[model samples]
Target: MGIKLLSIKNKFVAKCLLLTSTLALSGCDDWVVMSPFGDIAKQEAFLINASTVLMLVIVVPVLLMTVWFAWKYRASNKDATYEPGWHHSATLETVIWTTPLIIILVLSGLTYVATHRLDPYLPISRISEDKPLPDNVDTLVIEVVALDWKWLFIYPEYNIATVNEIAAPIDRPIQFKITSGSVMNSFYIPALAGQIYAMSGMETKMHAVINEKGVFDGFSANYSGHGFSQMHFKFHGVNDEGFDSWVSKVRSLDNQTLNHQGYLKLEEKTTGHPVTYFSTVGDNLYHDILNRCVDANTVCMDKQMHLDKHRAKNAVKHKE
Candidate 1:
């Protein structure tokens, strides 16, 4: 019997070692979302864990009580109380109602706090719990254009652009002004922040900051087309000096300009496209995309809306 027990222990240890070795070889990509590198993602993870624990507080007790009641009132247990006329217990009713109510109240409060605090539109107030952002810290704005299964990141301040890649300085706040060139898509970087939608003729905002330096994955969470599976990019979180160096490198490699005509060529469907850099972007390129008026003869949506409103007002006046 002792020999059998020793053999079982050895097999368990071998299986544990094998699992550990496999994980070590493959890296931690699977758990990267839960193990966040940014403040917003950390808070989101915390909220998820807290909510799960709060729910389990109710779930575990109910499950245990179910088993306990079944065992205690079993037909074979002769000592069990069996009052046929017994209908209800006030204490049981109160417990069944009150515990869940308390849990719900607590969960509601937690949800309220987490929802507003973690809103992607709201700018981050700090780098982390211990680091507060100063009033004078300028924000880095990266305009994101979701093209046909690819991402275009334009640095308006620096007059540089890159396709299928993005970067931000660590501990510095970053805001993304997102739009799509054609179909709707979702921009998601799991380690940095939550996902936000992007669609043509509309713009969305996402605010986040990377607190650690590493290369993380970014992808379109929404399905766009045949190339959707391959629509992914690399996000590099770097220090201030490294970020500047990266910008300089990107500027040096630029061989093309991303203007209206250039953007039109990019609208074509392709898969597994290589990362490309652009030296310049047209001044009104993003604005045109947002208004669905990139072509020269097309009327901007805002202007068309204004005309429609004016015509409606005139019609109402004539009727009166």
Candidate 2:
């Protein structure tokens, strides 16, 4: 029996050591959430770390107390106290209750500040800590459509569209107006900012800026269907000149135009779509998608709601 127990313990210890070594060898760079690139992500990381440390301030002492309690009150310890009338002391109660209350108050204030500062709808005030956004620099607007197992990005400024890829110049603020053609999905580019939802028939807004000049991964953080695992996109942050060159290169494609017809075709459910570009895209395409009118046969949500409201007003007048 002793030998069997020893053998099991040895195997368990070996497995634990192997797992720890594997994690250590991979390096922390793989954990992008802990190592942030953009200002929003960096703030989020700081908040996470701050909360963790705050909680640990209480947790570490309690864990040590537990160990100390076990040894102090052990059966073999002759110095252990025995008090049948042991009720909670005022000092102990105050320490236990007041400590948590103080921590909660601090956390509440921290959360409130962070929430407003990191509101996805709020435009970024500064590109970096030292640089305030200039009044002359325009915020780039990108309309995003989450299709079935794919993504479509439309740049209204240039009247161009792309699938499974998007780009912006470094330190330039971007406003993303997002909606869905099919099921709900989360639009997340971890290197740039946090996740925001894209819902059908309604538009959502997110504002963020990429500080780094590199291609990072963007994907649907929400699971929709079987093809959800393969849904991914690339977010490229380049220099101003490189962005201009990229836009020009896309314009040079010259032939493809994404109108409503093209959109319906692209809306079909498929997986693992490669990067595609459209030289021209129909105006108000995103507005149509937001109103659930990408298909000509479908009635737009706003128009239908307006009609319903008008009818209700007429009925009330007649009743009076």
Candidate 3:
């Protein structure tokens, strides 16, 4: 009876240790980039893992050999051969330089392939593993305006806009046209894909899609100003029906149209603004913003540039 009780106690202790180990490993899921929810992010995760494993092939062996050689060649061990004058060996020299060069070449090739393959401007070819984007499937276009301390997402197709919130249907590709209202900012959603810069008077593009249905956090990855720390928004991934419902809900809101006048107010320096929806959005609003002319009386940068060029030509013609 005594032996059986001792065995039971040991089993209980083993179970407790197993549970603790499992919990500790599960805590690592907090690394959102490694555990992604979108196809593009998954591809990025693959690249990270591949690169780490490739480097570890050399790193792990070198680290272990360092300790092993130190122990094996200790001064206390008289059996170890002394090589005070044997500094150079043809075989050792070949390996010392050749290994790192080979690794560099391989990594370079991988980086070259990944750079083009993962370019944000390139449209997504596949939605997820084994799922090629069908020709008939439509892509969602989102215009992202990085405001002073908030994010404004405009859905061109739906003619609706939202502040500090965005959403898209799962398994459908999303194309983002991003620009800043003021200074430069980085538009990032970790569970989606890489961060792309948003600059005033310039537009940047990023293509991505969500494979999972959940709420993710979106934020400015770069520090812009005093309110930079509060420049966070919510990104929702839902089904087609849910997306439509969300649009309907926004359309039903009493918020005014997001025109140049409205945008001027939004661009003011403020932080921690709650999600607000606008039923109507100005056409070519994003274009106007990209040109740094979201005000009624201001000339767009493109038009201003053209006028300047024409003026220069006229002045030269007069001289002639």
Candidate 4:
């Protein structure tokens, strides 16, 4: 009987080991790649991994100890030591508390350094360990306006613009200065980077570079109005030649110049917006949106600031 029970236990252990190995092997494919860490996207991923591992260092041991203690102290284990009133152990207490403190300190230091070093708004340092970004390589600046249910992408460098679709050259750094037309929203491209908020009358900048050529989906992560569900865009990372060709194709459009009236019409809530091209855009139009003065003679945040200052001065004079 004892031999039979031992044999069954051994078989069960072997089967469990085999199952665990198979799961671990399959998990490799699902494991998120942290390799492409040269960019901001990967940097954020690295931070996440670092914090998670640090936390797990404490969590795993505690879990194992809990299970071990429970089994070892079971009523069936007649040989186990037990003293109900013995709880305090100064040495054990110091070790348990100090070890976690050390882990926290290390984690906090890493987090603090990474937070500043991996700031999304910061420009790319070195493209790769082997190659440095050329000083003459001008950063591509795209002004993004989050509309009700669509995205407006304006490339000031090429003097061309597109709606609901954005294309950029692979391995080239791109900076997005984003703002919303009305309510607050979050700009997210999961395959590229994390989400960044877009608030009305405020411009938020994000830096990212796609190393591989692919089409990634971008959307509003924050819940806005009714049409927010359909608010989506395509991010294409192509070769430099392909990007140039795309620019030329967009430039060749007949009705590229989008006047103020046309812009207002385009800003309305729409669903599954077809890719539209603009050959020409109004001068400093993107700047106008960033300043929250897309409409004519409308009070902007800067103007409001001035008005508040003037009122304060007048109030001080009256008090005197």
**Leading candidate by lDDT:** 3
- The superposed Cα distance between candidate 4 and the true structure at residue 156, in angstroms, equals 1.0
lDDT of 4 at 296: 87
Question: In model 2, which residue pairs have backbone atoms overlapping below 3 Å?
Answer: none
Model 4 deviation from the true structure expressed as Cα RMSD, one decimal place: 4.4
User: Which regions of candidate 4 deviate over 4 angstroms?
Assistant: 1-38, 307-320
Provide the overall lDDT of each model, using Cα atoms, as 2-decimal numbers: 0.91, 0.91, 0.93, 0.83
Show where candidate 2 strays beyond 4 Å: 1-14, 17-27, 79-85
Question: lDDT by residue for model 3 over 1-320, one digit each (tens)?
Answer: 99999999999999999999999899796788999999999999998998898899889989999999999999899999887887678998898889889888888988899899899999998999889998998989999999889999999999999999999999999999999989999999999998999999888999999999999988999999999999999999999999999999999976569888888888889989989999999878888998988887899999999999999999999999
**Pairs of residues at least 3 apart in sequence or in different chains that clash in candidate 4:** 256-279, 256-280
By lDDT rank, best first, the candidates go: 3, 2, 1, 4
Q: Write the per-residue lDDT of candidate 1 for residues 125-206, one digit (tens) a residue.
A: 8989889998898899999999887998999988888899898999999999999987999999999998999998899999
In model 3, pairs of residues that clash are none
| Alpha-carbon lDDT of model 1 | 0.91
**Least accurate stretch of 10 residues (summed lDDT) in model 4?**
30-39
Q: Which ten residues in a row have the lowest lDDT in candidate 2?
A: 28-37
